[model samples]
Target: MKFEFADRVNRLPPYLFAEIEKQIKEKKAQGVDLISLSIGDPDLPPPPFVVEALKEEVANVKNHNYSFSQGEPDFRQAVAEWYKKRFNVDIAQDQVVALLGSKEGIANAARAFVNPGDRVLVPDPAYPVYANGSTILCDGEAVPMPLLEENGFKPDFDAIKAKKAKMMFLNYPNNPTSATVDKKFLKEAVEFARDNNIILCYDNAYSEVSYDGYKAPSILEVDGAMDVAIEFSSLSKTFNITGDRIAFAVGNKQLVGGLTKIKSQVDSGPPVYTQKVAVKALAAYKSAEPPEFLKKNNQILSERRDTLVECLGDVGFPCEKPKATFYVWVNCKGDSMEFAAKLLSVGVAVTPGVGFGKHGEGYARITFTQPKERIIEASERIRKLFK
Candidate 1:
């Protein structure tokens, strides 16, 4: 007999990064020296303090046990305090839900709120999780909100077919596009969510990995936002703990509770020691003076962005310097896949924009996740090939 699969899994579109990985592997097999500019994962080590914290806790057998479904209180408390220090938004201790990562929280939240046929508002050229694992897995319909270049990649609120969407996913200092929104637009989004009874989920994963004096704000900073919004954050980009899978979901007690309920039924929780390590990392950030490691990371990213923009800009690629996020969104003014394929042919791998969403069609997103030397070399290669 043939094995059967769920309709939900079968119906979803192809995973973009997986396809990129396949092409990468194939190129490598042919002896191609591929300079990958695809994935947004950070390539640097986290703070020494975070690693030390993990080492300290791992020795304590007490931390080897299964953590609470709602997550450790110390971890949650540290997250809350970090929020207060970073965004100046007061969060009650109970409103925070510790997550394996923000990605897990996002998927669970969608499971919590989206019933079959419910509409989910996702930004065009968005992080794939919002439209894929979150919405489709819940049997919900995805409604795309275009983040046009004319609007600085901020959603065209007036243009969005204002409807009763159950959830709206937003990423600022965004992935793929690297668009950052100010608090004023955030206020508008909050009001819209409140009026429409929408659950606004802001993925501020790239919050700390910003550039050029740009500080990304949490949606919870807006007045009355807690009544309708839940913000997800990650240490993946901020502290280079991607492998650690540590993050938190905060804001809107009811929404956090809902996500927790779903998580409890599925998985117990991430390892307890990792949560302890997260506590130390967040508490360190709670200080008035930002850590040197974080500062150094952002500086390197900023330099990479400049180097890439200068090289690509010289070849008439029309890449605007993004305010935050290490990605520089470029419009190839042609098919995104074709452009990406061309880059791969020249031993440079990049993410095709159309893989993000329909509106991503003439664009490609290049990341600054590699070392400065590799980035410079990739830029030179791209310039030559693009010309």
Candidate 2:
């Protein structure tokens, strides 16, 4: 017998990373030495201290049981403290909710607040979860806010056509685009959301991944943000702990409580052992400076980013070196999908800009997640094909 998927599931565009994974597998099966620069999964391991902490936490029998739906108290308090120390933003423990990952929290937050007919302002060429995993799954209409190059890959707030969008998602140290924004821009975004009576969802997953002394800010750092915005941040990218499924949503108690309620019905919070480890991870933030491990990790990624950008420029696909994130957004000047496929033929796999959204059509995103030597090798492969 055949089965029909629910409308929500059916509405999702083909998951971009899933399709990329399949292509990578097919290429490997053909005995091609493929170098995948498609997905954002980090090749680095979590700091040794994090690993050691996890090992100790798992041995405690209490950690094996179910945690509070919101989160363990210790973990929530750690989140609150970290916000103060890192962003100079004050938040209470009650305003924090642990997440399996920011991805799950984003989708569940949509479910908590968005009504079937509500409109959500989403940036084009964004991480697909904003539109696909979140808004569309809630039967909400996703209004595109194009992130154009002329505007530094940020959405032009005045151009938004939606008169009454219920929500808006924004990311900095952005995925796919690698765009960075200042606190001033975030303040404007907060004002825009407040003026429009829209709920703002800021994804700060790449907050710790920066280079050239650039630091990312929390939306809550803006004065009025606490009233209108909720931010999702992850240890996944920051601490190279993606597999641990640790992240949180902070700011706006109502928003955090609503998401926590949804999570209570659907699943338990993140694993107790992981939260315990994450607490230690967050506690490492003593002052404004990042932990030594994170600094070292960013250094490796910075070197790789430089090598890849230089190689791409040499091959005639000129792109700017982003000050944050491990991605380089290249202007391929043609059909991004075809350009990506052409590179794949040369054993270098990149994410086609079209997979992100229509505006991503003429671009391609290259990640420097691999070792520096591997990045150089991939660049040589692209140069051989393009130059």
Candidate 3:
């Protein structure tokens, strides 16, 4: 007999970034020196203290065991403390669940809250995981709310009201789009969730990667938000610990408990040493200022953003400068995949926006994850093609 795949898994769309990675590898195998601005994996090393903590914890025999399903108390307390300091929101330890990553937390949360055929509201040209997780894992329906440039990439509340969705996924300093939400919008979102009896799942992974005079706001910052929202955060972008696979879910106790229970059934907890290291990492975050290296990195990115805009402008493909995050969501003149394929031939790897959603068809996402010099070189190469 032949093994068969689950129908839900079979129906899922191809992972776009994985496809991009495979293509880039094939090109490099043939000796193409590709400058990749496709994925937002940070190139910078994490803080020294984070490394030291991991090293120290790994040597402790007690830390080698499995951690609590909910999380170690100290780690939960540390997360609570960090939220108090960073977002000025008070959270109890019971309201938190340690996750392998924010992505896992999101998928698990969708599983916990959504029943089969339930309606899930997702932002268009937004992160693909939200819709895919809901549709494939939870067997729920995805109602895409188109995010237009005219609305600064925010979904219209009226549109959401019309859909009568049961759950909504939101991410600010949003991936692919790099759009940030303000206090007024957040308050409105909280109200919308409360009025509609919807569960608001806020992805806060990029909160700490913000630049300029802007700070990324958390959904929990709004009054009554805790009653209807659950926020997921990761150490990936904040501490450059993507490989560590440590993140947390914080918010409504009942919701957190639901995800924790589901997590217990599917997977064992994160390693004890990792949680110990996370405690140290979060503690270090309390008094730590943004390092000069990141400031320098942002400066380099700022220059690259300007240069790319200027170069693309000359090519008749203009883009807006994102205030925070390291992505430039560019409006490609025609089909995004065609534009990306043409650029790839010139040794520049970019992500086609259509991979994100239908609304992303005319766009492409360029990351500033490459080195400064490579970015400038890529810009020059792209410029030559259009000129």
lDDT of 3: 0.86
Overall lDDT per candidate, in order of appearance: 0.88, 0.93, 0.86
What tens-digit string does per-residue lDDT give for candidate 1 at 24-64? Answer: 99999999988899988888888788888989999999998
Candidates in order, TM-scores: namely 0.98, 0.99, 0.96
Model 3: residue 82 alpha-carbon error in angstroms: 0.4
C-alpha RMSD in Å of predicted model 1 compared with the true structure: 1.1
Q: Of models 1 and 3, which has the larger TM-score?
A: 1
What is the per-residue lDDT of model 2 for residues 184-258, given as tens digits with 9 covering 90 to 100?
899889999999999999999999999989999999999999999999999999888888899999999999999
Q: Which candidate, 1 or 3, has the higher lDDT?
A: 1
TM-score of structure candidate 2: 0.99
* CA deviation > 4 Å runs, candidate 2: none
Candidate number with the higher lDDT (2 or 3): 2
- Per-residue lDDT tens digits of candidate 3, residues 241-282? 898999999999999999999988987678888898888777
**Deviation (Å) of 82 in candidate 2:** 0.5
